[model samples]
Target: PDTTVVVGPGGSFEVPLNPPLTNGETVTVIVTDPAGNSSTPVTVEAPDTTAPAPATDVQVAPDGSSVTGNAEPGATVGVDTDGDGQPDTTVVVGPGGNFEVPLNPPLTNGETVTVIVTDPAGNSSTPVTAEAPDFPDAPQVNASNGSVLSGTAEAGVTIVITDGNGNPIGQTSADANGSWSFTPGSQLPDGTVVNVVARDAAGNSSPATSITVDGVAPNAPVVEPSNGSELSGTAEPGSSVTLTDGNGNPIGQTTADANGNWSFTPSTPLPDGTVVNVVARDAAGNSSPPASVTVDAVAPATPTVDPSNGTTLSGTAEPGATVTLTDGNGNPIGQVTADGSGNWTFTPSTPLPNGTVVNATATDPSGNASSPASVTVDAVAPATPVVNPSNGTTLSGTAEPGATVTLTDGNGNPIGQVTADGSGNWSFTPTTPLPNGTVVNATATDASGNTSAGSSVTVD
Candidate 1:
């Protein structure tokens, strides 16, 4: 190497080599005083060829934006982001062998990058490899239930909630299990939309996830009239409806149809007076106020009827119930309400004919009617018979046809019995002759068993 003159402070002077000297080469230097006295020549060695150690403790930013580590002091750290065996960026190690390099177009998570350390001597160490750190993932949001919002994310991440317009609404952190929840300060109207993002400790934010809010509860259900095991109702379309007993035990569940109609049949029959409760819930799990109905499955008992007397009919039925009377042909005769004691009486506007059949039924307060009870009218009695004067041995009388005449003496002693002929005539001959002046009395009984007043004649 040729010598070149260099000027510096008194303590030390630096010399430049005209043709750069190779590593580990030797050079000779000569010094002369200001006066004419020469000094001996001295030999000096150039930098050695040994390379510095590769970067140690290398770490990449969670977002892959930067690389940092320790290296030999004064060593230059070169970063190869693409694994192409070429440095894309470099940084000089500082006093404590610490260096950090910022990367443009940062590496992605799990991407491999090569690092090499070179000292001032131009010697390079073997390349070291590092992987970009992973970042937090987007948060998962749950369906809104008209009351609160909740979901999951990476553990320890901060959750940022925003409205559909990108306005910040709330912030919270995930628990150790990556679960989180939030209740809005005020009610969100139905069909509101929101967004959520997860931010890591390194200030890196994941992509935003959009969520639709459903905040409306279904309307109260309208139950239909029912008296059997099955119940049906109307509610919000597509709502889930539940059936529960008075005590809140679950009975069954059903989903409403497009027309808002729903039905459910219990596994077992409910007893009379059992209260059934119904509730409707929308898709977002918002529940409506409960509605209730009482079961009235039992019908009134059959009425107890007395035989009709052509003009009036009477019966016993459930208290405070309505009793209706119908003829054998099912024509309405009359209706009356039973008293508190369950006794009812109905008088026809027009007198019913003898032998007319009357049927009675009682309807209770719940409008349930019992089976019919029937009775036949037999109010007329047979006419009195005419007894002819007779001797002690024989007696005769005129009575209604088809009737039976029973004869007796004036003392009320039985004489004989006889049936009337087609011409309404009857005769009875005593097995023993009656005494003189004994009175013969006759009475008539019609086919319906109605008896007439007696007529008397004196025996000659």
Candidate 2:
């Protein structure tokens, strides 16, 4: 992606490169025409004339665990791990003095390593010998806390403790039995992470151990089910479930079952329409998130009956809710559901009588029932009838028995009226013989005002 311009016919160009090229390197360049046809590529090599500086200051690591040395940068350093002095494996030396090289099979205290350096062109330097370091394996750590790091290690080895940042905290030697502990000068900060290592008398260090301080809180309890007073839910096993009312007063407590299922019966009965909170605590006094369950013992509002009384009782209630109709004595008369529209209806086996007292109640989806609503049934009229004595100037009828009869002239002008006996019969004769061809009609009304058809009679 570099820009260059060349002239036509006898064109030639030069490509520029940045600094930092190594000796004994080669680069090839190719020229292409505007149509992408390529010319022969030209090759060039940079000559290597200088050898690396001699290796120096070769020495053993503090613990003699590895070979460390200084050499010319970019030189390969060989470590004779088996001490035969001819290099076994060679490592590229980084840009520093006394860099460490790990021994595959770590050298024991009595073992030695012979190290040599070589330049890129294969020039070798004089050899140096280093003794191996002795160290125990990393310690097994557990239950370490604010002040103490207790664990198992090689018998009589010392344990060193440090914060996660590798800063020293404390150190202690193991007992003859291989148990060791290090107590920091001060308690470990809550939630701080710490690392530990084991060391032997030979000045070697083991791998570091890492641990995080534990103060984790438990998970919150889950409350479920329709009734708040009788709650069912999950919590940590063996934890205690403590319940409290909205006022923050203790209501009761119970232990969670082995499966983490729990139930608590409040010392005081939880009333409807109250909010309550529950907390779970482990034996260690670690509390779980607060679980809340609101007491909703309240049913629904008393259902009202439209039209007050009828074969079918209807009213408004919770949608998809169960509604019950009861007599004054609290006996269930009928049951029905309030539709999704929040409307409900119930019809009893026997029609309710006039002035009868009844009760209406509504239930919520949660099974809460409303207080009974008092309803007084209104009266119902009796059935209608037919008349008799069609042509005698006399009025007679078989209608509702014990009904009252009102007679009128053909034009509907009222002439007189009478009450029917229990046999359902009624007659009304003119006090004087009727004038020839006069017409009369009569209607019968029950005690409840249910009326019968009219009877018309002509004079004899």
Clashes of each: 0, 5
lDDT string for model 2 (1-460, tens) is: 3434464566656566565346767777667778988778777776664655655666666555567778877788888887576787777988664456877666775577777778877777767777655557889887443656688999988788877788888888889999987667776766778788888887778878788754455699987633454766789898889877788987778889999998766555567766778898875456788988777676677777765434656778767767877778887788888888988877677777777777877777545788777676654543444556455456566666777788777777776788878887777775665566767776776654445667677755
C-alpha lDDT (0 to 100) for residue 122 of candidate 1: 84
Mark the 10 consecutive residues where model 1 has the least summed lDDT: 1-10
Best by lDDT: 1
lDDT of 1 at 447: 60
Candidate 2 residue 408 Cα shift, in angstroms, is: 29
How many clashes show up in model 2?
5
TM-score of 1: 0.40
User: Which digits, one per residue and each the tens of the lDDT, describe model 1 over residues 1-460?
Assistant: 2664533457467787857676778888876555845559788887778888888999888777899999999999999987788899999999998999998888775687899999998889988899876557889997786467788999999999988888877899999999998888886677777899999898878888877877767789987645547788899998999988899988889999999999888777777788889999887778999998887777889998876557667879999888988889999888899999999987787778888998889887555779999888876878999888887877887999978899887889988889999999988877788889998888998765678999999889
Q: List the residue pairs that clash in candidate 1.
A: none
Candidate 1 lDDT (Cα, 0 to 1)? 0.84
After superposition on all CA atoms, what RMSD does each candidate show versus the true structure?
A: 19.6, 20.2
